[model samples]
Target: MAMDRLFAPPAERWQAVSPRLCSLRRALLTFWLGLLGLGGAIVAGVVGMWWLGAVIIVVAAAVYAFGWWLIGRNWRSWGYAERGDDLLVTHGVLFRTLVVVPYGRMQFVDVTAGPAERKFGIAKVQLHTATPATDAEIPGLTPDEAESLRDRLAALGEARAAGL
Candidate 1:
């Protein structure tokens, strides 16, 4: 199939997100939790006679907000495609990037569903490769799709390893 036919919308062509990645609800929820946790920590610190609570809270809140923004930004731009022998991940809003994971380099593939993902009927496929400290991930896939992709990747890795 042509690359365009294999991918999603043209708008998402640079970072073609999975149809399963519906919204940024997860990141928003995480941000709210982080804010609440930071507030709670500040209260606890003040109660314990620590004068740095306010400063810590301010710094923490700034960092948390930045992190939240980063997640939302990346989430909005993330997309992936499963090529014949490689997985293509395109992400980032500001510093756009594309990651290509060839079958030969993949160590293994995983299909995982967290509580939220399970509720949404989605799973994340994480591909571990020989590259140190760098793994390719494609999140927000339907359970069946995730499984199929996992099996395909595993088979490709094996085939490549066997010099097929």
Candidate 2:
């Protein structure tokens, strides 16, 4: 599609995030929504409001259904690429974002994985620049991939910075 080209990778090779990210998101959504439904139902019962409980449960279920689908789409939307002098990260379905972090401007790179992300076998690579606006991150990468990217970016940043 015409819109796809607008956000395509510079080198025509966009590396997508792991699909396990989708699973992680869906699992979290299910847990939170389930808790909401259960907690609401219990509160409604204690207050003698069966109708309100039903409404809450129905709303939570609806949100969970929508969230489950949206999570997959969102995960699929994420991608990153290392170009000649910059790293490109793109994401979003309705409101697209493209972040270009130049090697020369990179201050440091951070690789992190929270418990849930680790459970899902995924990590995030965050690029810190001298300017906050240009800071970017690529999430849902495998640990090995995240480390490799961090090393490459750090080397590039050092090389470029030393030239200045």
Candidate 3:
């Protein structure tokens, strides 16, 4: 099957959903904040007659740029998909990780919307499992979508628990 056609809606039972990631405004903010801090340190060091000011500024700028690049790359690679019996989360650029949470193992689901998420009309769905240490999460979902998913997951867990 063709790649585009593979992702065509309806025919594909599972679809990947990801947050919008960093907006242009957010990226600009990150860059400017980084630059500002670097500039401030440079000025302070120069005033203090520190010999390593130039090197520090250069290193800081490089680190900041690298961090921004990583964020953007990871953002593009991060997404979640809900299949028949499990929720799949795929993330990371350098170290790819895929987490599968089976419905039967789900303990509870939480649908939460923070200020930033509300501004973007997005919500986060956290799926708690019997696992003692880890909680599965699907961030950047629409409010209605998240609620619907939560309900469906809850019902599935309940049905599975009842041996349905």
Best by TM-score: 2
Query: In candidate 3, how many Å is residue 8 off?
Result: 17
For residues 13-32, could you state the per-residue lDDT of candidate 1 as single tens digits?
34344544544454555667
lDDT of each residue in 49-104, candidate 3, tens digit only: 46667666667778677777776776666566667777676666667666778888
Q: Rank by TM-score, descending?
A: 2, 3, 1
TM-scores of the candidates are: 0.61, 0.95, 0.69
* Tens digits of per-residue lDDT for model 2, 1-164: 98888899855698999998888988999898898899999999899999999999999988888998899889999998889989899999999999999999999999999999999999999999999999999889998899899999999999999988
Model 2 segments more than 4 A misplaced: none
Order the candidate numbers by lDDT, best to worst. Answer: 2, 1, 3
**What's the true lDDT of residue 123 in model 2?**
95
RMSD of 1: 6.3
Cα deviation of 140, candidate 3, in Å: 2.1
